[model samples]
Target: MNITSTLVTCVDNWLQNLYTKMYSHHTETYENTVEVHVQETSSPLTKTLVLRILINEEHKQVHIPNIFIPLNFHRQGIGFGLIKEILKVANVYRYELFIVDMTPSFYDRLLNRNAQPAGYDAVRIDTTTRL
Candidate 1:
């Protein structure tokens, strides 16, 4: 059987406040093409969530445009795992800049929030994770 077959189920209101805070409360419109991938696991055959990334080699940066975990899979480390995977790849490629393009509140919660220590153009947006 396909490992992704076992994944199932995929939000709220203070929940409303929290949601807005986490995702900009749907205030902005986004238009672009993003490469989306699923973070899957074997044995139990589970697909935790989806991640979107856009790499700009000319700018020497990796953009994590979106990271979404279904409601049923939230708080299960799926999101964190996805970020970690991207960061790993970014480091390997030696990308100098990492842009998150995500909510400011959510970016503060990431492990690499402080990865960029210096340089004026080194960081921007809550959408960044230093690799």
Candidate 2:
């Protein structure tokens, strides 16, 4: 998913968890979620950042459960790049449903970063339905 020189890859483990504690104020991990790892070509493993995206094939939807970029990696477009990758996968698999479980601040940031207008408003709670 490297749209540029920076290395963007998928990680199967928490080897970069140390960077989370050192660079973020929140230390909580998003358990049982798939992760997309980002890092510079010259950077070490500990310098990588984790972006979590949960895909539910039964619902044919994609979810952004967590987006955590290290403080040192902020303002470098890493977050946007990560989301771009997610969108690409969704488009390829014909999955248009998206859910962002994030704070207002991060939601605003996401909307400003190439997100389609009113996409969030398309979500419904399904109060009358029971599965």
Candidate 3:
């Protein structure tokens, strides 16, 4: 929860290690990892997230797991905007899209054609009931 941008490269590497361990430990290829992204928060570090992903050539979008923000940080639109910005950037590199199977505002209508629910991926954008 660094209330700032989490380097995608760092996240990718961390996830790789996490996935490998989980697969080997359980004798299965299912697992998740904790992810932290820095954004503007009231304090220093805020909430955190856990993510999981399974790559498929048909899709190209990465999965974002549960995203959360501290109660204080939830007041501002930073969390929502942060998620929007993340999606905007990551969605581009995809030729098709391998987004986690979930519902998002952008995926609601306009971008639905370009994005699809991910079956083996996950991420959540933290938002409080206040927002």
Candidate 4:
């Protein structure tokens, strides 16, 4: 993978439009919603979105509701890169990170990889785990 060509950006109006077009069924919105997108610059004229994560920053907490990476792009470190970027943001803001509705194994893998920034941890909340 060409890491130099990969770009991580926060959501804006243009991104919101693209996200809505891609995920029409996810209609719920939050006031503090933050989207982080991982795009690969395949060519000078084309940028492909390989991964996207929706996080809600509220009450000094960061809640990740969803993470999407195309099947073809899995295991390519795109998702990990996106999470690292989000971790940087969370570290700066000192927000407690929570992964909601995602498989616990994923969080475990991240933890095993030492992905969490210093003084910050990712909490997994789902049916199988309690707060």
Candidate 5:
């Protein structure tokens, strides 16, 4: 299978476990879901997950709850590419984007960088929010 499908399979398994753990104590059923987006290399031989982001869409808001990039992929432009893609979609749909649980240092680094991608300035960090 391609890297995207592989990543989705892996994430689905992880999410199942997470759901069980999170709702084990609750007697009521809850729908815990998020859209998973993966960024990976095009090469089949060296296919790697550059980044994975979870988006929770609600009403007119889009919440990015998690973004994971392997240590080896750090410093690459993959994160910016993913964010740009999300921004395009959000703009098209007129949705507000909120990044949740991002570290201040990371946010600072992204903003402080001189060569930020287009729409980088539009990103809003919601450190106190959870989705």
Candidate 6:
């Protein structure tokens, strides 16, 4: 018996609620889905923007890859809040996810920054906060 399927379904619904508020102007697709992608460049040299998807742990739930906020933007804390919001909700239901994947440039962007080194991977920055 896995509540994960149900859990993700619920999370997706809640996210859509917020997605509508934040991106109300931009029409969405793939019904009941809100995705986030973390890319490095604004308009990449290539047609595709490689985004890094990081999850802390997972029960193997389904999620759309649509949160496309560049890492540069995340460094400034834009879509980061949304990610945290979703992570907090997921944690509320007790679902843990881990870093899925990212491009080399994604790592390079952070390294290029003059800011103090958080680590080999700043993705370690946790989003799930307790109430």
On TM-score, the candidate that comes out on top is 2
Q: Write the per-residue lDDT of candidate 6 for residues 38-90, one digit (tens) a residue.
A: 22234434222222232323343323233454333335454444545555555
Measured by lDDT, the strongest candidate is 2
Indicate the worst ten consecutive residues by lDDT in candidate 6.
Answer: 46-55
lDDT of 5 by residue, 1-131 (tens): 53223334444444343234231211111232334433233335433332334434455555555566545555665455455555545555566555555566665565554322224333453222111
lDDT comparison, 1 vs 4, better candidate? 4
What's model 2's TM-score? 0.52
Q: Write down the RMSD of candidate 6 (Cα, Å).
A: 8.6
Which lDDT value does model 2 have at 10?
Answer: 24
Candidate 1 lDDT, tens digit per residue, 1-131? Answer: 21111111011111232333232222111232233333233323443324445556566555655667656557765555555554555555565434455565655544355544232223332235532
Off by over 4 Å in 5: 1-32, 35-58, 111-131
- Please list all clashing residue pairs in model 1, or write none if there are none: 13-16, 100-127, 101-127
Q: Cα lDDT of all candidates, in order?
A: 0.42, 0.46, 0.36, 0.44, 0.43, 0.38
What tens-digit string does per-residue lDDT give for candidate 4 at 21-118?
A: 34322222334454344333334333343333444434555566566765555676555555555555555556555555546676666556544422
- TM-score of every model? 0.48, 0.52, 0.37, 0.48, 0.46, 0.37
Worst 10 residues of 3 by lDDT: 23-32
Residue pairs of candidate 5 with colliding backbone atoms: none
Of the pair 5 and 6, which is ahead by TM-score? Answer: 5
Give residue 1's lDDT in candidate 3 (0 to 100): 22
Q: Please report the TM-score between candidate 1 and the true structure.
A: 0.48
Candidate numbers, best lDDT first, in rank order: 2, 4, 5, 1, 6, 3
lDDT of 4 at 99: 58
Per-model root-mean-square deviation over C-alphas: 12.8, 10.7, 12.1, 11.2, 12.8, 8.6
Q: Report clashes for each candidate as comma-separated counts.
A: 3, 0, 19, 0, 0, 14
TM-score for predicted model 5 compared with the true structure: 0.46
What is the Å distance of residue 102 in model 3 from its true position? Answer: 7.3
lDDT tens digits, residue span 74-100, model 3: 456554444554554444443221334
